[model samples]
Target: MAQDYSKKPIEELMAEAKGGNIEAQNALAMLHELGLIPEASAAEAARLYAKSAKAGDPLAALYLGVMHEKGAEGVPVDKSIADSYYHMAEKGGYHKAVDRLTEAGVGRRTILLVDDSASFRNVTRALLNKCGFDVVEAPDASHAIRFLQNGGRADLVISDVEMPNMDGLEMLAIIRGRLQKKDLPVVMLTSVREVGVLKKAKMLGVQGWVLKPYDNDMLVQIVRKALVA
Candidate 1:
């Protein structure tokens, strides 16, 4: 899974990354993350780093930890996820990730949770708030947009798809287009299995999803994985 590379050219690196080489993936991800190449893209960097880190590359894990900590474009500010990646790097003998982790002291990450049902919000708020998230409740998409428009700060958004007035996707479009918070990660809580809706959400840059009526542990796990990756 891990092979030592001897300073290959960009073409070679791209080829190796395409062939599922973890080190090559990390190397190319670094070049993209640093804008060292013409094809520099934060989303692509995050995707490559995620693949390498998932395959247990220490350097890739460290870079992902930094991206989560700093809220880089493709990744958001998620201390819980950042710390987990740092620990993975530490286990792989990379001490720099741990050093930076100790240097940055911050509070719990905040999640803007938009749902129309007051009862559902209460349950979700209790669940996430207890699990290292500071959840901000928005009864609907309009309220969510109002909060963001009023200069509200949210590290992530977890919103339900269907509601009385505005659907979550519509609010997501506004968030991506007008609000110009393209990097802000969003997760959808949806019962609809329509491929078009999910594709639209993907085009709008949603990070992940949790189907409606989700298990408590599974929802948290999905949120954590999305936060880091």
Candidate 2:
């Protein structure tokens, strides 16, 4: 008989979590935080994360930092709390979370690209490189905020509107309201053509729009125009 580990029961997992199993706690935290379980509670997720973090789990600390930083999963937007967890994660040897604090800094009109697509990010990065602008990337708004909060600079931001977790408009609102980066130029790259959406972007002070299936030359031109404008 072969043993199957892929089908662990939730009851068993919950029991493990109750028994001080750090990994199980983290797993449960994520499940609730991301709403994988029906009617999942963000508060419960935060509590689980707290337990795991107290046990010195670096990943849990990192996640708590992210949740606090982004105000997601009902963690409440609190940089002080986020900073504490980030520090804990770093001290516990989580390099990626720490590395955000040490981004190479920016030079020569840096561009921040926000999107969830890996291939798109790669292609855009290459294009921007050839255009002679330094490029920084964030898979989502939270990461972008983390980059900026941690000392990364940007002359312009090109973002896709529709994204999981947090959309570009919400990100822009945070950028303008919370971060107070009012003067930053933002370009929207999306396939959406809804009037309501465009109106919202305009109200948010979007500097430009580049529709998807975009032409290489046109995008480069828009970038140039946005930089100079």
Using TM-score as the measure, the top candidate is 1
At residue 115, give the lDDT of candidate 2: 94
Tens-digit per-residue lDDT, 1-229, candidate 1? 4554434678999999999988788768856764546868767887898898889887678777767765666567899988888889878877655554342211367889999999999999998877777889999999999999999999889999998789999999999999999888898987766767866776787876567787675466446545544
| Residue-wise C-alpha lDDT for candidate 2, range 8-120, written one tens digit per residue | 45687688889998878876775575344567786888899889998998778876766676565455888899889888987888654634422222235789999999999
lDDT of each: 0.77, 0.75
Worst 10 residues of 1 by lDDT: 98-107
Backbone collision count in every prediction? 0, 0
Q: Using Cα atoms with residue i matched to residue i, what is each candidate's TM-score against the true structure?
A: 0.61, 0.53
Worst 10 residues of 2 by lDDT: 98-107
**lDDT score of residue 92 within candidate 1:** 82
Q: How many Å off is the CA of 131 in candidate 1?
A: 0.5
